[model samples]
Target: MVMSLGQGLWMAINAIYAVTVVHLTPGQLGVSVSVAAAIVLVCSIPLGHLADRTGPRTVQMWSFLASAPLTAALLFVSGFWTYLVVVSAQAIAYRAGRSARKAMIAGLILPADRVSVLAYVRAASNVSVSIGACLAGLVLAAGSRLGYQGAVLFTAVAFLLTGALTAREPRVPPVPATAGSALAVLRDGPFLTFTILDGLLTTHALLLDVVLPLWVLRRTDAPRWMSAIILVVNTVLVVGTQTKAARGTDTPAAAARASLQGAGCVAVACVVFAMSDEAALVPACLLLVSGALAHALGEVRQAAGSWAIAFDLAPDHAQGQYQGTHAMGADLGKMFAPAVFTWLVLEHGALGWIVLAVGFAALGTAMPAVVSRGVRMRSGSDPVISTG
Candidate 1:
C-alpha cells in the first residue's frame, strides 16, 4: 500500500509535472518515459538474478530505499536531461524490486495459497491507489509550486517508510547459483512460450485504459461520463470478484484452462464493445457496462492464472529470476499495446474489433495445448490436457 500510494502520486502527476514545472515538451517527455521503460526490460532479468544470488528481502528493501532520494530529487529537476536521468534511475530501482518482492512472497507463501492471497493483495492495492489519486487530486487543485513539491516529498517519504517496513519482514535466503544452472528460466522453452502467451493476453490492460475511453468519446453515442463509469465498474468487479475468480486454479491444467476462459471473456467483451458504436445512447451505456463487466472478470481470471503458473511451474531455487522473466513479458506487452490496439480498434472500425475478438479467442483456445506441452515437458506425460 505504501509503495502504491507513492507510485499513484507520481504516476498521476508525472506528465503534468514534466510539462508545467520542468517545461519539457510533450514529445520529449514521451521519449524519456519510454526510454526509461525500455531500460527496465533490459534490467529485470539481471536484477532478479542478483536477488537470487543475494537475499530477496535485502534486495527488495534496498530497491525501495534507492527510489526515495531519487523521487525527492524531482523537486530540483530543472531540465529534460536531469528529469530523464532521475526518472530512469528510479524506474530501474523500483521495477527491479518487483522480482525480488515476488520472490520473497514465493518463499513465504505456500503454492496453493499464492493465487488467492495475491488476489486480495491486488484488491487492497486498488483501494489504496484510489485514495492516493484523490490526494494527488487535492494537490492538483491547490496548484502551487509548494504543493507540487510537497507531493513529491510525500512520495519520497512513502518509499522510505515502505522500505523500512519491508526490512522488518523475515529475510528470505538466497538461491545459490551453480556454474551450469544460473539463469535457468531463460533455458526453459515451454515456460518462455507460456510467458509470451501470457504477455499477449495482458495487452487487454492497455485496451481497457487507453482504447476503451477513446472509443467511447469518438465512436459511440454513449455519454462522455460513461467512460469513467466503465472504469469504476471494472474496479468494483475486480475488487469484489477477483478472489472467486482465483479459486479452482491450483494446478497447471486448471490454470491454463482458466486463462483460456479469461481470453474468451475478453473476446466477448470486445464484440459487445464493437456493437456499442452503432447503438442509441441508452443502449450504448448498457453495452459499455456489459463489456466492462466481462472484461473485468476476464482481467481477474487471467491475473489469477498467471500468478498460479508463475509460482507452480517455477523451480523453487530459481524463483527470483523466473518471476522477473515472467514480468518482462508484461513490459513487452504494454509497450506494444498502444500501437497495436489504436490501429486495430480506433482506425479500422467494426472489422478491426472482430479481428481482435477472433485473435483473443484463438490465443485462449491455443493455450491449453501449450500448457499440455509444458506439462509433458516437465512430467514426461501429457497428463493435464486429457484429465483436466
Candidate 2:
C-alpha cells in the first residue's frame, strides 16, 4: 500500500516536472534524462555495496526519509540547472532506495514467487500512477499553480510517512560477502549476457518517455492535453494486463516464452505508432496503450527470469551484490536510451521509429533462446537450486 501511494504521488509530481519545471527542448530533455540516468548507473554499484555492507532496510529508510525534502524543494526553484541538480538528487535517492527495497523483497519472498509479487507491486504502482497523473492533469487544466504545488508538497509528506512505515518494519539479517566475491561476479559470462540483454530491452522501452511526448505534440499537432492520453494508455494496460501476463510463467522456459511474445507486441505497437499519420489520436493512443502493456509484460517475465537466474548463480553470501549489478543494467539502459533515441529521431525521422521497432522485435525473438541456454548451464551445476 505504501509503495502504491508513493508511486502515485511520484508519477503525478513527475508529470508536473516534465510539463512545468524542466524546461528544455526535446533533445535537451532527453539529454537531461540521460545524464541523470547515467549518474544513477554509476552510483548503483557503490550503492549496492553499501546496501550489502549495511543492510537493504537501512539504505531504504534513510534514502526515503531524505528524498521527501529534496523533492519538495523543486517548488521553490525556477531555473533549469537548479532543477537538474535537485532532480538528479531525487534520482539518486530513488535508485538507492529501490535497490534496497528489492533486496528486502529478496530476503522475505521465495525466489519462485518473487515475480508474481513484483507483478502485483507493479500493478498497484501503475494504478496509483494513473490516479496521480489524472489529478495532476486536473490541476494543470485548472491553472492552479498553488494547487499543483500543494499536490507536490503533499507527495513529500506521503514520502515521509512511507519512510516512517518502513522504519517500523522488521529488518533483514545482514548477509556477508567474502573477499573476491564482487570480482567473481564480474567474470560470470551468462550473468553478463543476461544483464546486457535486459539493458537493451529496457533501452528500447524508454523511447516512450521524452520522445513520445515530443512526437505527439509536434508531429500530430496534439494539444498539451494529449500528454494525459499517453498516461491513460499506460495506466489502463498496466492495471488490466500485467497480472494475467505474468501468470503461468513459473519456469525459466515459460518466462522466456512470455517475454518473446511481449516483445513482438512491442514491435508491432511501435510500428503502428510510426504509421499513424492519418489516424491521428486513435493510432497514437493505441501505440501508447498497447506498447505499454506489451513492455510491462516483458518486464514481469524478464524480472522473474533474472531473479531466478541470479538466485541460482549467486553464492549465498553475495546475493545483494548480484542483485545490485543486475539493477545497474536497468539504469544503464535508462541512461543510454534517451541519448541514442534522441539522435535517431533527429537524424532519421520516421525511419528511427522503425529501427527501434525492429530492434525490439529482434530482441523478443532472440531472448528465449539465450535464456534457455543460461537455464541449461545453471541446471548442470545446481540441480536442486531454489529459484525465486
Top candidate on lDDT is 1
- Model 2's TM-score against the true structure: 0.85
Name the best candidate (by TM-score): 2
Tens digit per residue, CA lDDT, model 2, 141-256: 66466766777787788778888888887797776654334445566666667777766775645645556656555665445445555665666667777677667677767777
Tens-digit lDDT track of model 1 for 234-271? 76687788889999898989998899999999999999
Off by over 4 Å in 2: 9-19, 143-148, 177-183, 277-316, 346-349, 379-388
- In order, the Cα lDDT scores of the candidates are 0.78, 0.66
What's the true lDDT of residue 271 in model 2? Answer: 69
Reference-based lDDT, residue 101, model 1 = 84
The TM-score, computed over Cα atoms with residue i paired to residue i, of candidate 1 is 0.80
